[model samples]
Target: MTNRTRTPRTRYAQSLICLLFVWAVMGSNSALAELTIRITEGADAAIPVAVVPFSESEGIPSSDKISSIVQDDLAMSGEFRTLAPEKMLSLPSKRSEVYFRDWRLLGQRYVLVGALNRNGDRVEARYELFDVNREERIMGATAGASANNMRTLAHHISDKVYEAITGVPGAFSTKLAYVTRDSANGEPRYRLQVSDVDGKRAGIRLESKEPILSPAWSPDGRKLAYVSFETGRPVVFIHELASGNRTRIAEYRGLNSAPAWSDDGRSLLLTLSKDGNAEIYRIDIQSKNLKRLTNHWSIDTEAVWDHTGNGFFFTSDRSGGPQIYHKSSEDAEPRRITFGSRYNARARPDNDGKFVYYVHQRDRAFHIAKTDLESGEETVLTRSESDESPSVSPNGRMLIYATKQSGNSVLTVVSADGGDAYSLPASQGDVRDPAWSPILR
Candidate 1:
């Protein structure tokens, strides 16, 4: 094989080969680890907004401040610069108390204020947003949840405030599915976890000593489909989040990996090697019927559905090195979509169909890059040298991917246009295979 051919295989396929070989020899149990987010870069033109601390009623128990969560959510996006509570001239809990002059003097373009009250077994929040320049209330609402679900209530409020101000729905309430690996007593432990977009309230869904890869979320945000090797071989399983129930979906003999959910959530696009070569296949989730999509001698894997479910994008080495290809339909001929890099894989397209993101290797470093679908112009989105597994937010305003930080794997979030950046590093070990969940209904 030529060096170009060997490089793609080594960078992508070799890892799979090694994982399969290692899973065949060894196996253990796993545990959960929470991720902590830190803002690494801020956008030059970020909007200035003030989120005042909500006043709590008498006798209400102390808990996490809702305003703090909202500030973190907005600041983490890199699109907003939130003013600290200590810097505010006055803490307003309602529209009447907000002084537009004071906010404008502080250079804040917008302000959010609210109050919390106890109502039986639940907590109710009355929140309002004001435009400092216009001196008018732009949005106001009353939202409540069980007292124990304060975080949920806070995220819901953040979503509303974000939508009213940005004209785009916020993803603060969305979940992220990823794989975390760490050693326990010298034995490697693998865990599949789901957490809020800010890396809080993380809960373990599956654990194994064998490596887990490719955690894909269903359209409805109720389940996850991923590849696991706990049975001494890689197998695809659909895990129901609410019940902790897992159903084996793909357990072929040779290779079963890279499970991706369809837009409708009725079927999946998978990469299997049962026929002797790794190629793309579609399987009906309910009927268990399998249909092969690609017939190729070269490795074809990491398949993902485009904005429209009628087509898909996958990584294939058919030409020489691993490049991205798209098929209009299952029976349609595949058309190559990337040419600027010899190693471009893990295709993730935005929901609006404007651009497609993936891992692009330039020189000796790998970075996350995107191609404008209309103009075919490519732009590198990240400066990190070891970036992979790009996932776009539901609104297509932000992109998340895994990269190496301090010689450890960490997830980073950047705006879709490649502005502002934040890092979500694990408390221990490494985190990879990030999958952003769809907007909850």
Candidate 2:
């Protein structure tokens, strides 16, 4: 056991790694269509803040409302309850115009005011955040983007205001990858799409009559790895976001599925059935070097990095039904981590490494749940009955997953602690395979 764990046998890993080149030879919204984000439920008590409609400086672009976008983004977080524009006592667009006593009387803690000015094909947003209690400007900044890129500018302002108030960087600027299935014509048509955190400016990445599954984002948020059956069988592919170019990364006899990225963005943890039964393997992205991570005979897949580069959490049926297990190192003995259920898989560790979330089965329904790494306590985070594909946001404050509602698949997001929740249902089809992008700066 000591030797086996220390030395991972190459098996056919070398040849498979060499196959890197074998396949290498082959490969917004409005301005993107955006996701409609609606808060189905909220926390028992949320922070009270007010976002005043910006004073349009005449030449500003005619597009989505900037202040409204930021307000919606903050409200969708389930952390802040924003006062409606109609309820604002004043339409102050600067710090001096803000009257703290008026906001205090409205029970608001923070106030955001801004103005938009057009510059050629671009717009400059000068925004200020004020502390109602202290009667002072707490945060102020200016952001410029093409007039057509108002959405991005709004999101940036939202991130700044959110960070200034909560001290935790907001994930409003991050992207999301999800798969949409449309069977309108008769046959199922799947599309891999990228969209904003609020589901706006959705740009399609891959479209196929076949199925696409498990979209995984790289650490840098530049590429996505997923399984596509467009080639008649399941093959793993890595696609560049900027160019829409892809290289077939894995193709074996049985299964080439479940692609997960390491922290360094240099390799992927995948499950391949070339040898017979399902097992886990790590593949270097550039060199195509392959290292076997699990040698078990049972089905083992869906392994995710621990961020510390120590080991990973995976699912296996070695104990009977699928269960979650943690490996200390490449060859270390596997220890079972999910004891509360006979079925738990798809472990997603937060950046802080404090909690791990996965698809959990309890009683008879499936829901997204997380386990406290230090305390061994499990908390179910969603009320959705048919949930799967759990992806955590960059800051680990929230997570998105796929679930079925009224017989249609929809994406649902909830706070990490299961406080407030929202759902994103496609306007025409079923959406699944949600992957949250890493924080990009």
Candidate 3:
């Protein structure tokens, strides 16, 4: 009996050590994930773009190419259809060399050109944006950063170009957190990970022998809240990244999961099944006081807080087959947000609180969708067989979700307006339950 007790302790210590060591070293080296293109649902049209190969201004080698990365980033947004240089009448490196008439004949609306040179410890990049129809250079900028920082610069350029065209802030600079599962020796393992907006830098933040679900990042991007079954029962844990400290937020007798952090990072709104029925609950982070928000006798989980912190949107089966309902802190009466679907509904509000996004499963296929809360108009964003757990970008103009493509679970990103669709291959395991972190600086 004593030997058996020692064995359990020894196994737990090994697991903890492994988890800590892997997480601590995750940020040291970033690895790029391979890109996989997929067709998106509800795509209206693709914008036409022309990107000529960059020019060389200074005495720099010819091998440090960045235009390819920029092209991939823009194409993945699902909004832009890139024009091949082979199809171009002329490859222009400077504004003077551009033949506006040739591009206009190709139905191109915009054109991009750039120059690159090696700086002291970084690469100097300069790019220009032009309006093909007007024959005008609308925007121009310069950036200088280390070679290792090229990816960051490319994302910034994407943000600028996206914003210039859409009249909304682009979310290309954001990051995504998600859940991945692995099977080894007939046992299942789960891990929580974070990656770049384009699905690069895939690294694990936490791992468990049991299931880990519903990962939500704090508004400040310093912490994460998730449900882990490490203790043989579902519980909520808040993990701080900088200090490597983890604190148990909930370990009640029944279900304690689906943690969603408030916009201000002051509290967490989660679902607890302690009262015999799954219901939404809000817990103050500082005081640790628990407040039962919904008294409904139906299953209510996956609570998402409003940007104002005055209300939250969640899913409940009260009306049969999960539907979305909005509950206000000012009043206990819940208002229904989704009225179309009869099978499943999960609400994920944008950062600005102007839109409420969700997943609608119809005819055995799940799609990412959204509702204009003010207009009550529903738009289906994805038409895939399975797309779930969407997290909106910081600017709320883009989203990342988990989907099955070619029989493999992978992470996919699409414009919030449902434009471009692309996938990120998992470096280690099958990925799911993606959550985008709020911008942190």
* The 10-residue segment with the lowest total lDDT in model 3: 24-33
Tens-digit lDDT track of model 2 for 46-114 = 788899999887778767889999988888888889998888778999988988889999999999999
Sorted on TM-score, best first, the list reads: 1, 2, 3
lDDT of 3 by residue, 1-441 (tens): 377654643454344334433422222112222333443432458788887777766755444356766777778777788887788888777789888998999999999888888777688889888999999998889987786677777777777888888787666677777766766565666767777777766677787767777788998898989888788767799999778699999998767878988767899987776665577888998888988988765667778877777888988877866888897762668999887678556688876767898888777788888988898898888767777788887877678887776766677787888765677756545777778877656
Best by lDDT: 1
Tell me which residue pairs clash in candidate 1.
none
lDDT of each: 0.88, 0.83, 0.75
Error of 1 at 219 (Å): 0.6
Assess candidate 1 and give its TM-score to the true structure.
0.94
Best of the candidates, TM-score: 1
For model 1, the superposed segments whose C-alpha errors exceed 4 Å read: 1-16, 19-32
Better of 1 and 3 by lDDT: 1
| Runs of candidate 3 exceeding 4 Å displacement | 1-44, 56-64, 351-354, 417-420, 425-428
